[model samples]
Structure formats: structure tokens, C-alpha cells
Target chain A: MADVAQQILLSEIAFSYRSQNARVLDIDRLSIDAGEQVAFIGATGAGKTTLLRLIDGRLFGWTGRAEVLGRTLSPRRAAPRNWNANIGFVFQEYALIERSTVYQNVRNGRLGRTHSALSLVGLFSDRDETAVTEAINDVGLSDLADQRVDQLSGGQRQRVAVARCLAQEPKVLIADEPVSSLDPTSAEKVLDLVRACAEARGATLLISSHQPKLVAQYVDRVVGLKEGQIAFDTPAGAVTPEQLGSLYGWHVADTAARSA
Target chain B: MTSEQRISQQRRRVADWSGFMVTVTVGVLVVWAWVATDIDTGRLADSGGRIGAFLGRMFPPDWSVLPTVIDGSLETFHIALLGTIASIVLSLVLGVLAARTVTPPFIHMPLKWLLAAIRAIPLILVAMLMVGAVGLGPLPGILAIAFHSTGMLAKFYAEAIEGIPAGSLAALDSAGATWLQKLRFGAWPLIAPDLVRDTLFRFELNIRESLVLGLVGAGGIGFYIQTYVRTFQYDKAATLTIVVVIFVVLIELVNHVVRAALK
Candidate 1:
């Protein structure tokens, strides 16, 4: 177990955007193995996003021994400004450039690895073209690759975002509410693509979702979060309805009680 | 019954009081402005006959100097075009420097203040200074318009750039894109249309300012108009006035179409 690299190892991590006392995330211990697909399950304001942001280095003041992809985070200094070449973040809002073509949006995923001149001038090499084509193909968007991202449906746009992530060829992929914006049918299709793509690349996938059952069959593990701490970490198949009810305590005790 | 009688009635009373306060404040401000400007109906009644006499003199506009006025009008248009182009190019550069998303406060704050300082100086005053420096011509007018417009355009560009949401910006950052790359992909798409619209507006505004500068001897249609009126050639001045009005109306129509197409 120790031989293989730990993709994420955050312990006793605490952070707050407002003040030292008003902590938003206070995870005591969290770990993910290489190539592990883990889904974080929590209601709104339950530190799931804060945890993801902490790993992504979007949030700072990590009060404890927090390390990501083997790099140790420091309390005295903020996280180092390095290119996150091996990590992919799928934002909930689809975040694709509205005016840019699907190919152009997906090509942005390769920006981390592409030469500055190549990316800015948009003079993609044969290799760059191949990568972009492959990513578009991966997301099943080849027929509409020339279309602008804003022209696509909500589901198609999410797929484009996933394609952009796949194009990055990241070793660790973190998706924040990847399916929340999609319709029921679209959400299923998007999740399948995300799962299949992650498996093909063997990337360590960490996704956060408010709905537990929505992602139960897709992710191998479900980590429940409450308030600012980890409430439970269990295999996806084993998460009981009661556990989900307790996790989403924002529904209040009445709702949880009624559900029980 | 209690909700209506006590709560709703109290809310209505509060709203009426606030409305009355706003009305009285506006009334006071308007009265003060009227007093300060010495505006009186009695004075307007006294001046009506003289105003009518002046209007009568402006009629039967002389057409002999039409060619000279045309030359001056073209110069004004050219000044506005050249100045707008120069200012827009400079705005694109300085706007990026001043953007909060792109620049740290160390750079952004200083650039913002400098732009504000540039805007604080009246364009007419700048034109006068340039006229003195360059020794009288539309060159000074062009330079003055460009100088004043740079401050305005850069500020608007910064606002447009800042209005872009953070989610897309964060996506670009996480993808290992550099600051310049992020701006190119993230900021440019959202801001380009607005920047184009703002450039058109500045051009229109600069055209009017160019005419004003011409009155001060910076050399445009207004220069001819000022010279004509001073020499008691009201007819030629009236002709220039008609031409200027027509030119401005045409430009405004073009501006409307371009802005609509951009949207």
C-alpha cells in the first residue's frame, strides 16, 4: 500500500476565507490512492467544495500537514505557483469560453503543456492537432467540434468540459458537481463519459456531489462530509439511506426524521 | 386584521415619508440651481425680440464660402478619426495594465489613478496647451482628443474586463494557462464587443470635442464658423451650422447600427 504513490494526503487541514475562527473546511484526515475514483458526498456548505479548493490550491491557510501529489503545503507561505499539469478540475458551471469553438475550448486543456507561442498564436502542431482531435473524439463531440461552446446544450457543454479535462491527460482529476447542471438523462450520460474517460486514463478521480445515490454506481468510494469535517468515509455500495440523511442535515432533523 | 392595520399601514406611512423627503430635496436643489444661474421668466421675455432679430440675420446664409467650410469640416472628421484610432490602441494596452484581474494592486492602483488624473484635465484645456506647443492646427486637436480619450476608454475597458465571472477565469488558471494566456482566452472574448462599442462612442464624442477645439483656433469647421460670426458673416456661419448638424446626425445613425450589430 505504501509503495504506490498517494495521489492526495490531506491531514488536519483547516481553512477559512473570512477569519481564523470562521473555518469553512476542517478535515482531520483524508487520503486517496493513485487511480482511485472517490466521490465526496455532502449537502451545501458542508466543506466539500472547500476541500476540493484546498487540494486545487484555490484556497490557502491550510492549517495542518496537507500535501497533494507529494508536494507539501506550507502554513508560513502560500502554495507554490506551479502549473497543475497532472491535475484536472471540472468546474460545475461548464466554464467554457462562450465565443470560442469547441475545438478551441478543448485546446485550452493542452495549454499547460503546449509552448507559449503555439498556444497564443494558435499555431497548433500536428501533435497538438492530434491531441485536440482525440479529446473531441473522447467526448463524442467530433460532429460539432467546430461549433461554439455557447451554442451547445447544457449536457453537451458539460461533455465539452469533460473533454477539456481528458485532453489535459491529468493523473488526478477533481470534478466539482459535474452533473448538477444536467437533466436526468444528460447527467447519466455525462457521468458515464466521466467514469469511462477516467478509467481509460487511469487518473485518480475525486468528484463532489450533493446527491449520493446519483453517483453510487459510478464512483468506487463515497466520502460523506458534514459542516467542516469528514462525517463518514465508506465504500459507495455500503452507504445507507440513514447516513445520507445525516450528511444532509441542512434538511434539518425534521426532514431526516421524516425520511427515517 | 392586525397585519393590515398595524404592519401594512406603518409600511405605507414610512414609504410616504420617504417619498416626501425625496421630493422636497429635489425641489430645493432645483430652486438653488435656478437662483445660481439667475434664470428668470422676466429676463427671457425681455430678450425674445433681440433673439428673433439675431435669427433673422442668420437667414439667407451665404454659400460663396461653402468650399472653405467643407475643407474645415473634413479636417474635423479626420481629426476625430485619427485621434479615436490612436486612443483606442493606447486604451487596449493601458486597459490591460489597469485591469484588477490581470494586474496586482501595485501596478493596477497606480495605473487607475494616472488614468483618472488624465481624465481630470479638461479636453479644451489640453487642446489649448497642445495648440501652444504645436503652434495652431488640427494636429493639436487630434492630440488633445487622443490624450483625454485614453483615460476614458482604458477605464471602461477595465470595467468590462472585470465584469467577466471568476468561474471561467479559474478554469483557465487551473488548466496551467499563464496570465497572458488566461486573459487572451478568458478576458478577451467577454470584453471585445464592449470595447468595440466604447471605441465607437469615443469617436462620436471626439468629433463634437474636435468642433469645440476648432472654435478656439485649433482648426476645423468651427474655426471657420467662429471667424465668420466674428466678422459679421452670419449667413456663412448659419450654413456651416446646418452642415455640422447634418454631419453629426449621419454619424449618430452609423453609431446606432454598429452598436446594434455588435450586440
Candidate 2:
């Protein structure tokens, strides 16, 4: 079902806050083909998140000709009902319902596809339940499916977030700094689970991160952002210390020394 | 010492003086309140002996009116329970509107102020109004408690809603959740326990308030207590008081166990 049109295309995109004097994001052009796993990496304020948010359809009031999933995209967070069915977003904090079980959190991912009345009453169809169970198994949390999210460990909670997105059966999956808040081992594990799941589903995965080394192995291409603009878009293997130094405002010699 | 240190010391002295001034102002306000209310310390001292004599008469504990005491206590409990249920139902709706995170300022501000305005009037005052409007019965007392408690519970609920991570709301919002769906998935889980605890706490307070509403002819234990007191039936009033104390203890024990379970 992959169309010839790019999965994501933003041309002459510029977003600014009306309250602020300067624009936070100003991208000349960017495009991602269907099923491409791309990583956006840069310093803290480099608009990596802004770019992902735009494609996720959670941002508004942008000057751009944006087309996502082969349709003209609005800058607003919503369009026609179910416009966001194909896009799923995973927040940095896992964002699993602390008071709810892993099963419910994962099941909620398919909410957009279901009848609103069913979800309003906290019910899910058998089809939704199957997808949820499959995703829970995919994330290796099937044993903890009935367990409350608050009862789980941090890494386990992050896995629940990944499972939630996977259960959505989305065509485009966006994860914003997914591993930034986890311990090193947990971070690696979450990344592995998310990367493996996205690949299996053949979803267009867009991960934003400041840790280049962590994301390099997961993505085929890396787009380096500098002050709200893409400084470089290259194959992940082609990224080097020099480009990294420029993205994070590190001196060339300092980055080289660290690498050496 | 550095000039900065000397300046810091001077600022500390000024802050201490300001704190002292605030204490003095509070003291003055207290004095003003006592004066305006015409609280007679002499009368309080004079009543000490009478209070002792009254307690002396109650040492044998009259068990004859136990049934009446129990009946009044049950009525009070019923009123409190019904009011609590109604308050929680209404607060759940109003609280979402009061929360600034999900609601726009236009809606949030007015709802917040309305809750505050409702809360400004004491439950007993509301009960009196209800009694006046709807005849003397438990219905008026229950309605009074529900109306007043709605404001109190809504404030607590709104705070609980606002206290959780704002990012959680964004997570659900990004999922293309409807407003009700966002509340179900985002807000409900975060605030459910707190809302329950607050409701229990309000119910405990409502029990006490319901009795007072009864004193104002709103119908409950307070009506019996008022009748006993007016007719110098101190032993019966004392029995009713004992029942109320025991009832409150029971409610607190339930609250403690329920709160622990929530944890």
C-alpha cells in the first residue's frame, strides 16, 4: 500500500510564536519516503522536536506546504475525524496511565479506529483487544499486561509506551527523545524494542534525540539540526565527529579528542 | 566580611521586621474579630462551673433514649452520604471545567470564581436557605451539604487535575482523543484516588455540618439535640453527642482503611 508520494514532505516550513520575536523552526525543505527510519539529532534547542511535532500533527500555525501520508496536512493538531489514525506519537516520559493496567494503555492506542461510544464507556472490540495483546507480547510485557503501570519499573513503563504506539498499527511512528529519561541499560533496551517493533511493522519511524551514538544504529539516515534548521542530512554511517561538534556547538578539536 | 554579606545581613533584618509587622497585624485582626463578635470572656469563665455540674449529671449515662439517639444519628449519616454522592457527581463535571490545563481561561476562570463564591457561604447557611425554600426535612440538609460540598470538592478535584504532569494530557491529545476521551485516559487515572480521598474527607465534615443543619430545623441529630437542650434534657443531649462521636470514629476508621487501600 506504499504510495509513490513521500510519506512526509514539508516545504518552506517556518513556525514562530506570536508572543516571541523570533521563529523557533525554519526549515527550507524536508522529505521522508514511506517506511524510512530517520533520526533527528542535535542540541537541546535545535528544533528536532519541532520538526517531529509538525509531522505528528500536534503543532499549529506554521507557514509551509506540508503533505503527510499523501494528503495536504494542516498545521493544527487535528483535521477531519480520524486524520491522525496513521500517525502515532510516543512521549519521552512513557506517559502510560499510572492508574490503569498495561492492557488498557495498549488498548487505548486503537481508540481512534474504534467507535467513540465504545471507548467512552472504556470498552474495546475483540479486534482491538487482539491488537493490544499482540503488541504487549511484542514488547515482552504480556506477563505484565494485567499489571498497573505504576507497579512497573521505569524501563518496563517505557516499553508500555512503545507497545501503545505499536498497537495503534500506525503507518508513521514518532518518538520524541524516547530513551533520554531512562538509565543506560533501560535506554538501550527500549531503543532495541522500539526499533525492532517499528522495523517489523515497516512503519516510518522518526526518533528525535541528542544522543547521536544511541540512535545511529537504529536509523538508516540522520538529520542534524542546528538552531531550528537542518544542518546536514546524510546516511547514518556518514555522520562524523566534526558534524556532531557543529550540531552541539562543540569545538572540532574537543569532539575529535573525545572520539579518539 | 564582603559588602554583599553586609547587605544580605541588612536585608535579613528588614525581613525579620516585616515578619514581626505581619504577626502584629494578625494579632490586631484577631482582636478586632473578638470585639466585633462581642465574645464575652467573662461569660465563658462563668459557665465553667455549670459545665462541670452538667458533666457530673451525665456520669450514669442514660441508656433509655438510645433508640432515639441512634435514629437521629442514622438520619445524619444518611444526609451526609447522599450529599457526598451528589457533590462528587457534580464536582467531577465542574472540576474538569475549573482546571486551567484542559479548559480555556474564559470557562475556567468563571467556574473557579463560582466555586469560590459558593464556598464562601458556610454549609449551615446554605442549609438554612434550603430549609426555608423547601420546608424542614433531611432533603434540605442534604441539598445544602451537596451544594456547598460541590464547591469544596470541585476545588480539590481541580487541584488534583492540575497537579499531574501536563505532558500526560498532551500525550493523549496527540493520540487524537476527544475531550471526554482525554479525561478518561489522561485525567481520571491521575486524580481518581485523590478525588476519592477528598470526597471521604468531605463526607466526614458533612456529617458534622449535617447535625448543625439539623439544629437550624434542617432535620437530623441536631434537631433532637436542640429539643433536649431547650427542655433541659441534658442527659438525652449527652447521649446524642456520644452517638455522634462514635459515628465519626467509625467513619474515620473506614476512611483510614480505604485510603490505605488506595495507596
Candidate 3:
């Protein structure tokens, strides 16, 4: 064990789906310290989700030297179950079991920690139940805890997704385009909840978003990606207009005119 | 006329022509079928009196045969119940195997063909074959129902399984859920209502079909229908027919209640 502060480190990583010829991710190096918050900003197909999935250990079949949470990850095999439990992924589109109640969906996050057979039969330890309840409370969904997810509004559903991840007691939280479908007000609320949850646990947070300005406020550093490569990596406040223009292929004046 | 007006007029003309052609085609088909079956309006009119005579014979449904009708009805119910249970067990396995999401194309494609083949074989034909092989009884009827119903029920089950959202299962995978846990919490909850509704519908069909199994000596109220009609015991046959209609209606009502409760 290195006993180092770097929670995630990747070098010479490249990945592309076998069915498609185009490369989706090609990164030379990236590192994040433990408990640091980072945002990946890119347009669609810029590999933001792919990179986040890679760090979350949910993606495989890549050539890479990637170390996450002091352990080396294999490109061929999935990360171990316990290692997966230590990281929470809030997927885009909520990805909830729509027929299940909010409490059941959040309780599902404790599956890795519970006895497999016991959990299958709907038996959970008191600690697991408490954690699920607390996670639901943290997301301010205690009243809707028993309500089915399909009946919820988009914003409330996203909160349930965050609550599910929070129940994992993860050391690293990865949210992939968490607020893409939400309105501006709801988007900020979800972002705030995700960041606050990570901060409360002293967990590393990695969020991918197309809205760089909004996401930059929650994360300390922003990495701008274009066509599977890093265009710029800078402090959140230091992201330049030129970098944004190069990344999106639109000048600031054009953007201003379009908005006006 | 303007170009747009000309275009709209042409479109309307094409629609009218197609509609006119369809009506002519249907008229021709109806006349062809009428000629092929032979003109029988006079005979059909005369048959009304025969129908009345038949009704007169069945009017006083033999109350003495009530005990026999009840016994046969109970046997029919049991056969349907057992057959439905057996088909459910078989469908659970075949349905998962045939689900495109659960199995590869080669595997699911062949299993789906097998289910379709099973469905194509009529239930009565299957019951007849069962009787020839296993001899006369409810056992053969149950086996026939199970075999015949698996075709439709398994396909329905496969469709239900495929209808589950893939993203929900992936979310469970990211949560570190094992394959079985994903099935229990992710796939099962998402598909449970669909599976229940499908099973209930299949059960209803099974009940209706099983009623006719006894005609093939497979054991049910249908045996009484065959025997009474053959022996010219029209009143007794009428009693059995009435019982069957009541049973089918009751099953339909129960299915409706179950479906509503699921909602």
C-alpha cells in the first residue's frame, strides 16, 4: 500500500467500444487527491461519462494503468465487489427501479455490505436500515420514502438517485450528468446535495456536466475535454474564454450574440 | 390552381381511389364466399323451427343430473388449476431462456421457435395425443394443458422480462449487487406486475381450454357433454353447458379483480 493521498491516478489510458471504430477516450494522465472535488466539462461524445465510469470501476476493456483508492484496476476484469461498494455512481437518467418504493431503491445500495442471501429475502441489519433512512433524510425525501419512484417528478427522482448512492457510505462519489434533464433550479439543488453529501463524508467527488459554469461552482477544478482529449485543466475560477471557445468551437462574442 | 392546392387535390384523389378499391375488393370477396358455400337462405330460415325444437328439448334441464354436473365441473377446475401451476413452473424457466435480454440470439431464437411450435399444436390435438399415450384420465388432461399453455405463457413471460429497463439493472450492478441480487431487486421488481398480469391471463385461457379436454377422454365436464349429447340426453347436456358458462364467467371476474388489485 502506498499510503498516498492520490485517490485516483490514470496513465496512458485509451478505450473504445468494440462495436465502434472511433476512439471514445484517450487520456495520457490524470490524478486527483483524496477528498478533492473535480468536474469534467464536455459536449456530448467528448468521453466525460466514459472517463467518470472508468474511475468508478464500472467500465472495462481499456488499455490503462489506473489506480483508484490505492488499488490497481484491471482492464479485463471488473473491480472486486467490496471495492465497488466503496465508490457510489449516480447514473444519468436516474436509473431507478421505477416500480419500487424510494426506501427500497435506497436500501438496494447496501446490497454489497449485506449478507447476500439475507438481503435477497428482504432481511437487512439494523445498521443498514438506519443508513438507508439517514440517506433518505439527507436528501429531504423522508416523507416520500414509501412512495414509488415512477410517481415522482424528475427532480425528486434525481434526489432519490443521490440518496441511493449516499446509502453506500462511499469514499468516492461519481455522478454522471446528474442534472442534465432537470430544470435550472432543480439542477442546482441536485448539485448542491451531491456536493454536500461528499463533503460531509470527506469523500472524493467527480461530476461530469456540459454546464461548465454551473458545475464549476461546486467543484474546485474543471477539466475541459474535447474529442476524447483534454483541452484544458485549470482551477475552476481560472477557466479561460479561449479554452471554452476552443472546446465548443464557438467564440465568446458568437455565444453572446446567440444568447442576446 | 396553386401548386399546393394541386398537390392536396391529388392526395385526396389517391385516398378516395384506395378507399373505393377496398370496398370493391371486400364486396367481391363476400360474393365469392357466398357462392362457394352454396346459397342456403331458405334452409337457414327453415332451421329456425329446428332450433326452437332443440331448445324445447333442453328447456327442463335434468335436475337429476346436477350431482353429476357438479362432480365433472370440480374435476375440470382441478385439471385447470394443476395445469396452470405446471405451466407456470415451465414458463419460468423457458421464459428466462427465451428472453432476448437474458440469452444470446442463438439460444433465445431457438427457444422462441420451440414455444411457437408448441402453440401451433391445438390443445385438443395435444389432449387426444396424451389420451392415446397415457390412457383416459385427468392426468393426461393436466399434462396436455401444461404442454399447450407453455407456448403462449412462455412467450408472454419472455416479453415481460424483455420489457424491463436495462438501465435499472445496470444501476444495481454499479451498486455492487450480485447477479441474483440484481434479479431479485432490480429485474424482479420492474417486471413483477407484468409477470403477474400475464400469468393471470394465461390461467384464464387455461381454464377455458381445459373444459373441452374431457371430450377426448382426458377428464372434465366435457366428457359429460359428449356422453349426454351422444346418448340424446339433451337436458343433461344443457345442464353441463350452463355450468361451464358459469365457471368461465366466474374465472373472468376473478381475473379482473386480481388485475385491478395489482394496479
Model 1 lDDT tens row, A1-260: 54888768988788777545667888788988998889998888888878887777667556888778888766655343343756888999999888888998898887777776666876767776787899899989999999988889999999899988888788888899999988899999989888898899988888899867788889999999888889889988898767887886544566556545
Residue B131 of candidate 2: its Cα lDDT?
89
**TM-scores for candidates 1 onward, in order:** 0.85, 0.90, 0.95
Report lDDT (CA) for all predictions. Answer: 0.85, 0.86, 0.92
Colliding residue pairs in candidate 3: none
What's the ranking of the predictions by TM-score, best on top? 3, 2, 1
Please list the residue runs of candidate 1 whose C-alpha ends up more than 4 Å from where it truly belongs after superposition. A63-67, A70-83, A250-260, B1-64, B89-121, B132-135
Q: After superposition, how far is residue A19 of candidate 3 from its true place, in Å?
A: 2.4
Relative to the true structure, candidate 1 reaches a TM of 0.85
**Candidate 1 clashing pairs, residues 3+ apart or interchain:** none
The candidate, 1 or 2, that scores higher on TM-score is: 2
Best by DockQ: 3
Q: Please rank every candidate by lDDT, starting with the best.
A: 3, 2, 1
List where candidate 2 sits over 4 angstroms from the true fold. A1-3, A80-83, B1-50
TM accuracy, model 3: 0.95
